[model samples]
Target: MNSLSAFHRPLGSTGLQVSPLGLGTVKLGRNQGVKYPNGFELPDDRQASALLDLARDLGINLLDTAPAYGISEQRLGPLLRGQRQHWVICTKVGEEFENGHSAFDFSARHTRFSVERSLQRLETDYLDLVLVHSNGDDQTVLDDQVYPTLAQLKREGLIRAYGFSGKTVEGGIRALEQGDCAMVTYNLNEQAERPVLDFALSHNKGILIKKALASGHLCLHGEDPVAKGLELVFAHPAVGSAIIGTINPHHLEQNVATAIEVLGR
Candidate 1:
């Protein structure tokens, strides 16, 4: 098996390429006191920004963040200001939060407002991709509000592509069948979404795997679980990238090195 660093795949048919291992910034912002087995500390804004710079330096180009992740967009946006062209800045809407609690708000107006807010926060004119951040089982949100708003954004040139983030396999398949989304992020370790991954592969939709290590659960019981789990996902013909979060540059370097070794790049 190849090391984790060897994986770089195209994100859908959008012509945007990304490392198979991308940086997920949710934990970088505020983990909300969530504990990881590695005892990893969540980095503050300065530290997170530095980590992002280092990740980019290491050849990780895709950075995923969400408005729901308290101040993540607010923090990541500024750090990414001048390097917009060098990386894929992907953010999400439909989820809102205050005081660390989150709620779904997929209304068209909210979606529009969210994009504007993200642009303002990130200090960028356009986002590479805007995902409908659904918590699974929100078909009404996808059918009625999410797609329509994203369509408008694409028409207006505010976003390059749009897709959905599913917490369940059924929801992922539903998004793929709808035929408007360019990519989808599905949970790989759960294995509940393999059929969805297969469907996405058949349709040529971009597939990004999330929780590939089951939020570090897999890592706790084994050595280099992130490396192993990512290898499995990258081997899957459908997967385009895997988004993993870590505040440690050492860990991030390990991820990139593993990819380079595994993918033979």
Candidate 2:
């Protein structure tokens, strides 16, 4: 019940196993244009490296990063050098952030280029997972060439699996039908995506829950809201992993402990 690795589960039928909690690296790479309840500073290389070390020791293997997360992908490359096999990296394409602004490119060319760039930045020959970073218009983004390009990459051995980080129920279902997984926002404050989780459960597809703590906003309420929120997230059978974006080592440890307790029960 204490070791997170012991609770690792299959990510649908992707043949890849991930811990109950994945580390989300947005705060490690970017601090601007975020929706957290409070402001924070980016961690230095030493601090970030230590955080990764702690995460590994706690038995978390899934690391979620993206091009839109400022220089997160780039920083993770150097920080995670020589330890690539110890982790399951899940990155995204389609969305890119620059000058504090965001842009979307779901075209076939960009999708292909993004995968290669992510490979270069992560210092890996192949990526464990690649998701299409939807621009809130989930259905429209899926209708583009992004999904098909990811499929091609998967077949080419560039990526082990591909999916969509979408915002809609229909999009999540469509993603699972066409790919291996879907990342959706499922937290205490948001249950609008429950249908997506239901579909994933019925279809036996992978589902990654984003904003499980409501970007830390849920903590503003009653006691131990983080624990309550995590309880709600892990209560679902479809959740392959819940991505928690905590840069604080103490917070990370507490989150993992809470998850172990929840999963144990």
Candidate 3:
């Protein structure tokens, strides 16, 4: 097993590489209505900067945030600051949450607008990856103007890669056939998304595992369900990375160490 400081892998054929454990930032911005077992106070700018510094110290290079995740993109902009080149930023389009409700727009216009807005919010000229934040209608969103718009953005050098964080296997496959990555949910309690992971691996498409700890629910009553969950997730040859969003530095370090132990990186 290798330490988190030694884990870096290619992201399919996008010409970009990332660490085996990408840091997710949902908890950083949104706290109005979250599903985490415990309540949390949103971190101030200083704390967020420290967290980024810690993640960098731990050798984490990939960051997963989305426009829909409250002000995560905006917050990261200033925090990342001069060190922006050190991280692979993976953000999303198609959905927005405000006043405790989510509204989705998969239109070509909205997709392009969203990417431009994300770039502005992140204070970056280009994005490493941009995924379609599906509204559970994965196929429909893919079939709509969103995917094509992203493809165009890629051609124009606005985004390096495009992907789908979908809700179904059918949609996951569709996303892969297009030669982009898919963020699927796979954990001890829910394995229904295994087929999606398998497809991505067999076809050489990138696979980023979301909810690897079942969105923080897996540790509710377990001796250590997270270790068990990540052990299973990184064992597969096709597993590219696992996005774990932990606000606590200790928890983040432990998760990375556990992955290092499991994958023998």
Candidate 4:
């Protein structure tokens, strides 16, 4: 199969192009309080760099990270030095990870602070995209305070686009109504947020899929569950990219190949 770069598509109305799959970097920062099917040690710098090289060679350009993912942003900052233009970096605000726990703050002040911190952590003057990390209270998270703050940041050119990584279908719809994109969970095991995807498709907004492989829990005693799961996700034309968090090089290659095969690129 060819590289995914050949199939890059517009990320809604954001004026940015992205790959069909994004690399989720939660494993690069924290190995604690996760739901992965297998335990893994955090890769060292050399190993992490090698994985990134493999991802770029595979034509994956989108990178998903968040402050709630421990030090993922911190690590990516140095790792991505001098190659910022090649990536469509998507990070989050409103949630923080510390002491093996997660905390949420959607206030305007914290929102600005979080964005600035991410800029510094990512070692970039501008972020390609910034998403609000929802604490499950989607309505409250889409409140006037934090959402507007992100909009202001976009206007100020600190971020190219802004949206919410929401938990509810209603919140996902509302987020797209006021922002550039919305991240939702849609997979074989869960379709509760399918309405959100439909809205994005109808409205020409961006949709990023989380837990596309059910966070690595969809492995069944059958033939190629990964391919089956990816087939279901790619069935939605609104899906801008599905974030896969696998750190294994072989799995990454397989996923890229599967995406290429599914899309027939």
lDDT of 3 at 40: 92
Error of 4 at 213 (Å): 0.4
Q: Output the lDDT of residue 83, model 1.
A: 86
Q: Rank the candidates by TM-score, best first.
A: 4, 2, 3, 1
Residue-wise C-alpha lDDT for candidate 2, range 113-132, written one tens digit per residue: 99999999999999999998
lDDT of 1 at 120: 94
Which stretches of model 2 miss by more than 4 angstroms? 220-222
Question: Please, what are the lDDT tens digits per residue for candidate 1 over residues 14-74?
Answer: 5778777878887766667444665555677688778887887787888889898778888
Query: Over the full model, what C-alpha lDDT does candidate 3 score relative to the true structure?
Result: 0.87
| lDDT per residue (tens digit) for residues 39-120 in model 4 | 8999999989999999999999999999999889999999999999899999999989899889999999999999999999
In the predicted model 3, the residue pairs found to clash are 1-264, 2-265
Tens digits of per-residue lDDT for model 3, 1-265: 2246567888877777888899999988998777788989888888888888888888889999998789999999988889888999999999899999999999999999999999999999999999988889888888899998999999999999999998999999999898488888888988887898888777888889998998888854646787789888888767778999978888888887777777674
On TM-score, the stronger of 1 and 2 is 2
Model 4 clash pairs? none
Query: Total clashes, candidate 4?
Result: 0
lDDT accuracy of residue 152 in candidate 4: 94
Best of the candidates, lDDT: 4
How far does residue 35 in candidate 2 sit from its true spot (Å)?
Answer: 0.9
Q: In model 3, what is the error at residue 96, expressed in angstroms?
A: 0.4
Candidate 3 C-alpha error for residue 261, in Å: 1.4
lDDT (CA) per prediction = 0.75, 0.92, 0.87, 0.93
